[model samples]
Target: GNEYPEDLAALPPQIIIGAQYVQAAGVALGFKKKGAKNVAYTYTGDGGTSQGDFYEGINFAGAYQAPAIFVVQNNGYAISVPRAVQTAAPTLAQKGLAAGIPGIQVDGMDALAVYLVMSEARKYSVEGNGPVLIETLTYRFGPHTLSGDDPHRYRTADEEAEWEKKDPLVRLRTYLDEKGLWSEEQEEAYIEEVNEQINEAMKKTEQAPKQKVSEYLQNVFVETPPTLEEQIAKFAAKEEA
Candidate 1:
């Protein structure tokens, strides 16, 4: 079932957060209360660190020694706001220090490093050491979203170029090539295979039945927001017609 994505027995995601940043703390604590063996993780932006929920969640997780991982994607900018304006802290990872959680900073551009740190963080959480915080130092290669956000308003060309050099794909490919493990032929074949799979999935999606509003709510989260309650009722009525 869609509700049981992946191995439901291994990881049952009971809580789905809405727009409220406070939900992070509440959800993680809920999972801990249930005596879950797996770690619960939540992600927020650099700007989101200012949200009271971010602090509340970390504190709660630390207090109970909940298996929660707080992931902060410091993508340089929180939408239009720059990181410098967000906080004067030496590093975002250190924010967890106040909550009694250990912090690990990693090069967001280095995929291997990010994986290793996250792996260690998860192990720490499962070991009941409490939640660990990970601050991946990355850049927003594009606008915050597909919206009318333009990075040109704040960032300069040189800055973008600097990060561009640290592209995870390039670095990984370069390292693999140096070890005679990658080549242009291999890349082309892999790209072709991935594109074929993506296209097939898109075709399936397009041919699938038109989803009711209620189904949309079930897709990403189990909890429905108050605003969506009315919409869900209306969709149910329309679907019955």
Candidate 2:
């Protein structure tokens, strides 16, 4: 899912932390060179701002005046570490100042606000303005991952309850309902449609063939290295056995 093979414009995000920022700048520069109006955008957590690549990427984009957007989802935590512990910057958006790019912060919980901000940012960038840094004030409801994190360990239930009140889905649905645009029946039907689609996708996934260890090893190299050749042989032998 990290790699969207079907979408050519959707580059696979780098696994190395903060690497996508620089990649996006490069993509934006490529578009500019081709005289295209397209802009490149990438996202990272508040914690990712600490990485050296973040500064380098933004700085490069700034100096070259490449059309790019860097979004920081300041969910208040980077895994187990709180945002306060990450940096002393008054606001993450201000980090763009050092790179000579425009920076702004918006209410991450309000979907409409985010949409408006992104619209303006896209317009600014595509119109020859360099990169923009946007910090979205948000919160995480559950563990960073379902694996080892426990929100209760670091954040208070009171804080969680406060954020739950600002849930974007809830706010958006309320606004739609107020405008007489959404109804319970429509919501129910949409939910059923989504459930069916998810079920079908899961069924297809369950029926997919399993990949072998040998296949993974072989795919890693075009001309297999001697070390990998030995590994492939050992795994293939074990698998055949």
Candidate 3:
């Protein structure tokens, strides 16, 4: 998550698909119990909407009227599978209707539109209302991952070029530039500043103390089991040598 210890809300990367939906619901309920105005927010792909946990999580939140925001990025493809084959739902946003929560769809490619919609969703959620489901209609430009999958096999060049025209960054940058709020010089300077910050972080990480296998084993349990204790001792001995 790269989140600071003091930060209460951070979306960590999880391997389990749609598991965080349940977690976000629980966190939102916790905030309500504490009488805090804070809301829990999480994102999932169109593919994750098919998971049982996704439905269960939204149902729970709706039942309790928990303040949560479920942002679904419908990028037209879930890995190599196209959206049509994934589910028969007319719109992913409508999936929340069964849970008795309001759902809204926004043009995800329009950065300003997304921002406005999210702002309204957050406001609705925090005002003693239940969770809101937001479906952002977007597109994936490349394969889900760099791992051997080829986009050319499933996606055509014409489709890729069409989505490229609607790229959010380019559209937003163009809008800002037209309004005299941005320029190529400013963008170049920002890029240079970000690179310098990255380099400084890398230097600090290089100077940090090396991690130990024994340290990991020792922290695994409050009272280490006999088998694990034996392994820890063996690793410790090797580290010392």
Highest TM-score among the candidates is held by which one?
A: 3
Tens digit per residue, CA lDDT, model 3, 99-194: 999999999999999999998988998888989999999998888999988989989999999999999999999899999999999999999999
Q: How do all models score by TM-score?
A: 0.73, 0.78, 0.78
Select the stronger candidate by TM-score from 1 and 3: 3
Candidates in order have lDDT scores of 0.76, 0.87, 0.87
Error of model 1, residue 59, in angstroms: 1.9
Query: lDDT by residue for model 2 over 7-114, one digit each (tens)?
Result: 225344347879889888887777767667777889999989989989999999999999899999999999889899999998999999999999899999999999
Name the runs in model 2 displaced over 4 angstroms.
Answer: 1-12, 192-241
Model 1, span 77-137: residue lDDT tens: 8888888887889898898899988988889999989999998998887766778889999
lDDT of 1 at 67: 73
Clashing pairs in 2: none
Q: Clashing residue pairs, candidate 1?
A: none
| TM-score comparison, 2 vs 3, better candidate | 3
User: Can you give the lDDT of residue 202 in candidate 2?
Assistant: 100
Q: What are the clashing pairs of model 3?
A: none
